[model samples]
Target: MSPFKGKTGFKRILNAGGYSLDGLRAAFTGEAAFRQLVLLNVILIPLSFFLNVSRVERALLIAVCLLALIVELLNSAIEAVVDRISLDLHPLSKNAKDMGSAAQFVVLTMIAVVWALILL
Candidate 1:
């Protein structure tokens, strides 16, 4: 048997919801960009209520923010998996990270456009 198979308890925990929780925990704990986004969302969501915004506008704002968070999480996952394979400055790894960053930027731009149309 493999040495990793010895921990039956860990196996059971992994089979439960631990894996999902662990991913969220890692995002908050390890990803700086995610942490910043969450902070901004915390402020923005509440401020939207007091902004005299319409329901549709509020929904759009929230949707865009959630999309940003989703993109950030995916990017963080990609970076983590790439780092897991190797930490060296490989070209493909750099491309992967760059592409993930680009995706986040696109989402951020969408969010900005949506909010600008609503607020300005």
Candidate 2:
């Protein structure tokens, strides 16, 4: 068996929660774009509920908004790992970062399209 499978039950859940919180804290502190998106979410997520829309539309709105956050977090992780590997200018590293950025751009566009379709 894998050595990492020791923790189980409530203890595992607590540990997982702690790790997730740590990740969020790290992203909030270190990533400016993450902070901005988080601020946007803070305003938009609740506002979504009040918008005159069907329940499915509301859920889709919220889900896409949250998806932006998820994508941002993953992008930040990619950036962190790439930076950790090297600070020197490297083509592969640049490509990795650029791909992560492109991913964010695509998701942001998706959010816009989803909101416009549902609300407009």
Candidate 3:
């Protein structure tokens, strides 16, 4: 039995998977923040398993770490699209980029709080 659902679903899944990989590649290669968060994930996800925590606590620890990466990817995407539209500085573009940065900041703080609560 194949892992994919139906024939058409299988093709769609493959295409979606490829596109997802491309996006990750672009984020990692082009966005330093994305790469830094990936490094944090590479460290934290494995460390979560080793910590003497319950299943739920362990999951929470890992989940917030993943959330940081997800927010960073969105931030990078927003910045990329804004830059693609035009290199010229504009207030709306500044707002868009700043809001994305704010989002990333909140998520990173979330990771810290979650880890601290779980570990301390």
Q: What lDDT does each candidate get?
A: 0.89, 0.93, 0.91
**Positional deviation of residue 22's Cα in model 2 after best superposition, in angstroms:** 0.3
The superposed Cα distance between candidate 1 and the true structure at residue 75, in angstroms, equals 0.4
Candidate closer to the true structure by TM-score (higher is better), 1 or 3: 3
Candidate achieving the largest lDDT? 2
Model 2 CA deviation exceeding 4 Å by range: 1-5
lDDT of 2 by residue, 7-115 (tens): 9999999999999999999999999999999988898899998999999999898998899899999999999899999999999999999999999999899989999
lDDT of 1 by residue, 1-120 (tens): 776555567676775567778887999999899999999899878888888888988988888888988999999999989999999999999999999999999999998898888999
- Across 4-85, the per-residue lDDT of candidate 3 in tens digits comes to 6445767888888998999999998988888899899999999998989999999899899999988998898899899999
Candidate 3, poorest ten consecutive residues by summed lDDT: 1-10
Q: Is candidate 1 or candidate 2 better by TM-score?
A: 2
Of 1 and 2, which scores higher on lDDT?
Answer: 2
TM-score of every candidate relative to the true structure:
0.82, 0.92, 0.90
Kindly report which residue pairs in candidate 3 clash with one another: none
